[model samples]
Target: MFFKWVMLSLLLSRSLASQQEEDVGFTYNGFRGVNMSLDGIAQITESGLLLLVSTTWAQVGHAFYPQPLHFMNSSRGNALSFSTTFVFAMFSELTTVGGPGIALVISPAKEFPGALPSSFLGLFNMATIGKPSNHLIGVELDTLQNEEFNDINGNHVGIDINDLKSVEAVPASYFSDQENRRIDLNLFGGQPMQLWVEYDGIEKQLNVTLAPINVPKPTIPLLSLKIDLSRYMVDPMFVGFSSSTSALDVSQYVLGWSFRMNGQAKDLSLSQLPKLPRRGTKTKPNFLKIGFPVFGASLVLMLVFIIQFIVRRRIKYAEVLEDWELEYGPHRFKYKDLYIATKGFNEKELLGIGGFGKVYRGMLPNSKEEVAVKRVSHDSRQGMREFIAEIISIGKLQHRSIVKLLGYCRRKGELLLVYDFMPNGSLDKFLFDHLSTTIKTKLSWNHRFQIIKSVASALLYLHEEWEQVVVHRDVKSSNVMLDKELNGRLGDFGLARLYDHGGDPKSTHVVGTFGYLAPELSRTGKASPCVDVFAFGVFLLEVACGRRPIEAGASEECHVLVEWVISSWSRGEILETVDPKLEMNYEVEEMELVLKLGLLCSQYIPTARPYMRQVVRYLDREIPLPELPSLSKSISLPSEMSTCGDISMWSPYYLGSTMSTSSSVADSLLSGGR
Candidate 1:
């Protein structure tokens, strides 16, 4: 129904609108005096009109009349064709002074029958201008040599006076073949000067003023000559300019043009001319022609200078320790000084290994600052790259429970990271081995609850408040380091991946400890916020039950601990699942809520798990309790519920119970009353 309405609206819009063509403009400048004529060919295609020409001598002409000339043909009602009207003008005043016209006949319907390979045809009228306009006629030329028009017999054919014969009639008849009227050629005699083609070959160029009386000059100057051709002949057939004189000794001055019997026009020799401006004689240089190559060389030199400047700047900035002390403290030293202070990386200075790298305890020589120098292995495959990325990704991470990263060092290959040493060590020491029973005894139920919240806040940092949302894939108890006050500090992000909002979800290789890994990793191989939720569930179960994900000698039933937590919680017997050290020290309501959150996180489906923000809210009482998880008995218990029957006895009391007397006592009381 929605698609139907959209279609209807589209139809209504189409009915109200129509398509139209918008006029576009292009530029050219060649065939002068014939207002806006172009020297190249113009053709039409599906994408509208295109004019191809060279800029040196070729120019485009604008249509004086409307293009695609439409007219009534009387028989056909309308004729569609393209045509142009032009007036040719010359640039200089050196040659003929006479009025003679030309005829231009365009035959769109005629074809030369079997004469040439492509039915080629040409016509020649006179040989005066660059290339005669006569090559487009029906006749084919035999031979052309030395600017002379030769016949089949190798004899020169002079120009016909038919164009001058019709000069007395109207100019419109110049396109007509109507005979019976003729015109005469009259010209003024004068000495012909040496004419040359002048060009700037640069920006400014000359424009044509007059055409009929001008003749192009040659490169070499020579003597001038005079001739007038009206004394020679009449009733001519040529279509070019000619001169005649009725003055004294007119027969001594004879000017005529030669024409070929089978005619063809010559192409313009425009490409041979130099494009640079002729500023001076042969010895002087032309600046315009040389400028482009010089500018190109200058640009290359400037680029090399810029690259050298940047390399030198990086060398000066390599003294990083000077700025490091300002951001951190004054005790920071460069890598060279640290080598001397640690006595050449001796084994005695080595601290235990952290996820980042092996930590080395170092003491400054003259100062009193004792620091833990984490000597990250340059060959450790995981070192400064991950460290630097984590610092950049977590720049605005403001959570109090997450560990703080001080300023770092980027030396040659080795990374000497300095961090606040946690004196009490990590949570794994107490939970896994029960080593140092003193610390284990000190870990009470209250301390355990605080640790749970602290870790949740740290996950909240990784999930929401950081500059980029970070996934701490390895979030087991081993990664939760404890500071002096036993506060949990989340660490170990070597396998971490970051996702900004609206970015693609992180696709990763299947990593992290096997038991704590999210189920979706096996299917999708992608890390979302739910991945961290899965790891947090395992951590929560570990802190509450004091159980590792996989017991050393356990069967398949004990391998996945999340399945055991849910089974024990749903039977109203979660107390049996609590850490044995607690011994009823923890609150029952809080335990139920924490167990529910873990169950929600450990859902086999990724979408069912809540975000870390939601997990933190549910723990802090900002939201209501979620639904109880459905437990399947197909999952065998690692350890049987020791107190389920005991807790079931209290459920009825909590729901309000009923009391009744025995039948025999009721019967005796009734008889006594009677």
Candidate 2:
């Protein structure tokens, strides 16, 4: 009797040690008025379904439980067992293409400010990504394979730590209870699917399972990762569903949700769950339902052959598909899709006609996401496999200030490259065209300064931060684009050459805009980071001085922009060269800084140029610019102002290989084009 009393007392104390929220759990058949905190594109539809994300371009949405749940034992400060299950359906206007999917997260806070949309899923932005400061754990239902995060496929489930890169992942599938075999599942299939997430704190194991709406919980989970959540979770953590869309438009819906602490979650009431909206036009007709088996075999075979011959004759669908490109299917666009998106290459959709090819404004089919498609004539001599592979590799780049290269398509006679559409167009139009017009669209000095830094940051990313060192042979104002928010995004990687870090780029024919080419290129056709720095220097001058590098003059003398800026600075009147369109509304110190930096970048000698990393530090004001005496020696400006912008100032200089703004690779394998 005394031993019984002692045991009872110990059990009671253990119960008391547990927090209140740990003993409480919640279940919702539908979220009509549930205590949910919603942000961004998240909302509750009138039908009582939780709509986390709708058909919006590049958006993020989060729906968190209003109160923080006790995730860890209060007395022991150790992670406690928990379970959650939710019914979700994701669909797109198109059949296969869907938005990047959602994550079930237990975050430290309900709101993540400055979180980037798209693949980041509103969890972290570029600056905060992969940082230990983000204390969160999640189970991700990712439909998009992000190479940057090392995702395995388009449909998978993963265990996320502080970052989106999963600690362990598996193809989204569930072991069928009836068949006792694994069956595949597509998260974006537009059919309601149920997901179960459970953690066993004692065993330090996490498991996630998925199945069709009516199926029983699988005995085996789709993904299981052994991780101690106590390392990242606190006593109280917020539980939420977070989703984000890319350029694609898709809707993510939660029909019903249930969660519990220290126990099994209540099963969602499927019968009472809200209905999912119909998706993807009319349901595709299953031809099997319309029996045609009665027809003779010969007749059926002949008809099929005729149909295939007709399709083969149609040039639009004649894609140059090679066996080598099979692995790149996820990154390749269907030719018919691009054709429909660009409205059969109609003139009405023409965004710009450059020397490379015509760029068309397009609304991608199904996603209805806007894109800019540039169609370049194909070169049969270049190996199509390597060419497409290189372009796809470039598409992997992710940065805020660089225009995104989405994907590419290859048809009968041309290669189509797709990019994110910038509504504000090229920066050169605002700088030069606005100079002669009464249109007040001229950029203020503040915008210009920010743009200079934005481009500099992007250049630094290409040169130092990326996996490979990329030398943008053409870094001119015309290549820079402006987003809707007036932020600068450097575009046009067509003329860019990439090499491994600490490796030298192979010598190639001079290929870039005329005035932007480095003088060393004429002597040694070698492309290097210094070559790009020289062009960036010229770009800075073009933005601040509002003049072309080489302008035609009345006599044999042509105006060289670099010399003009240097001469003005030499006379102690550098401010005289500032664009008058700025209305002198700029800071004197900043104006002097940009002009001098521009000079330092455009030094005639390759050894004199500062690396892109140093340039970014200077622009960001993290380091002080060197004084004039030393700065001048590195700059090594011309002895006299040149009447011409052409390198003809240096006698015997040959520029016979300089290509136009849009360089073509027809003659030289390294000639970069659209």
Candidate 3:
């Protein structure tokens, strides 16, 4: 009996000690409503803990547990393990892209004094980034790409050790049980997301799992890395979250958090946690109940005043909208209508993909008219500006050679533009489709000639016939759409600028595609009618030669189509530069005239290039082609003539790549018409 009692006592003591260790770390049922102990930049809100560095730019914010937790002393000794589960959300007040996301940081201090903003995630600055002494371990939930840090994309989770450079990373995604397929999660889409991070001390392994709060825990982890924390961590370290923003703003919220140390704890059942208190539910003075009748009368009066004020404001707003419609002439679309038309912007409906957003083909329910819907990414700095530019530049213009803007939609967090669908897609398809013999689509020489003339007429309308001089900065072959009759229609005026006649618009930023950028625009960072002419020169050459302005070649000179074409012309072998697919079917005289015209418009001097009116006349044979300049002289290339614009503001694919959608849609519907 004595021996049995001793054994029972030992068992009870071990059980009690294990339970005590489990309770060592913190657990909060609800961050805002619950009485949980914690620390760091956390704010009690109706929705829970709002974790933010600041409400403005170039700021860093963090939240951490008040007390430090024990870490492994050495690689050879017993180590402490931990498991943490939390629900967080990222949002933007301005309907902009929110980024430089949150990080689960383990550091020596709760406050990261030297933390940097933007892509640094408030973790490290320029001096200490990628250095060894930083001695920090972080599981970063990054929603913005920082090329300097080698980020995969805008939405990803990276394991960072002492640097912004990730040791291992994976895209933010969750397996949807309802859909039975993995769906890419937009971390900044204002949806609550759940995260699970675990560290195994014995194996020195780390695992991170993520999913939507409404979904079950995925069986597999998004990221798994074998790392020995003892090599980097101090004996006791602060563990919590840190986030920062620059230029772009995002709100971070922590609804609930629970953590355990020393081993795996029971999985948290977040569903049972108390819901956030409803707004206006806080305690009020008891005397308010005694004065109910008087208060009710005041409330009724206030409500009447509020309703009258709202009605007046709405009336004024509608009047302003009516005036705007009279001026712009672009129809305003209902958000719900466009959403339904585009099938909720499904990936399968995607037509053309560009840097700023994706173009989808949708059919309007009432009209049964097919339309190409351009959905600009909310996070894009240029998207909203481009959206405005497109409306101003294309909305009022009506021409047979210009893509017609049907309408636009702007809701709380989305901007969309709708255009008439072009059945034949973009001109690049005809120029490059010959590369694949399996596809029989080809543009005859006559069709190509008509396209050139039509595009020139469109330019003429913008520069001379329109009320304002609209300079299309990005006028590449991809921007030329082909209608059902294969007639060229100018499109994609996102980078266009409208200026008064004879006015030179001075823009601080240079925006255009590579190989097509005008030499003078690089030097001036200004847009003029001449800039469009220079791009037209490149486009003309591309269409005539059925080749890109720049192509992979053995020599640098050979890579530039202009230099190579000039060299061929000097050798009296200009025909060699013509597309082999033409098969000697085109008129030699017409081809030569067009080629010389292209060379004339692509002059090294911006002032030397012919205006859109002269280009139109030259194509129509109304004006004679000008004398060619000396081909022997070396051309001076512009120093700043490179790919411009923020690459993060673009989609992953090239502007005119083949779509993964069904072949029927690719053949019939307009794809890459941007």
RMSD of each: 36.7, 21.1, 14.5
| Model 3 Cα lDDT, one tens digit per residue, 201-261 | 8788899989988888887788888888878877677787888765443577777777888
| Residue 27 accuracy (lDDT) in model 2 | 92
lDDT tens digits, residue span 146-233, model 1: 1111122211112222221111111111111233232121211222111111112122221111111223322221211121222221
Please provide, for model 2 over 1-674, each residue's C-alpha lDDT reduced to its tens digit, 9 standing for 90 to 100. 99999999988888775756466788999899887999998999989999998844467899999987888877777899999999999986445555689999998898998676777888985446667768888899998777557788878999899998889998888899899899988888889999999999899888899999989999988887888899998757899999987645578999899998888999988899988776534453333344456786666666666665675557546687777778887788887878889898888998775434568989899899999998865654556676677677778889999999898887755678899999888888888777445335778888989999999999889888999987778888888889988899988776577789878778874567655777777667888887888888888888888876755331212256766665566557778888887887888888888988887677665665677887888788887776442221123324332211223121211112553223321111110110
Candidate-wise lDDT, in order = 0.41, 0.77, 0.69
TM-score of 3: 0.50
Q: For model 1, where is the 10-residue window of minimal lDDT? A: 665-674
The candidate scoring highest on TM-score is: 3
Clashing pairs in 2: 558-643, 558-644
How many backbone clashes does every candidate have?
24, 2, 3
* 1 against 3, candidate with superior lDDT: 3
Q: Looking at model 1, how many pairs of residues clash?
A: 24
Which candidate number would show the highest lDDT if scored against the true structure? 2
Badly placed stretches (over 4 Å) of model 3 are 1-330, 377-393, 435-439, 552-557, 631-674
Tell me the TM-score of each prediction against the true structure. 0.41, 0.49, 0.50
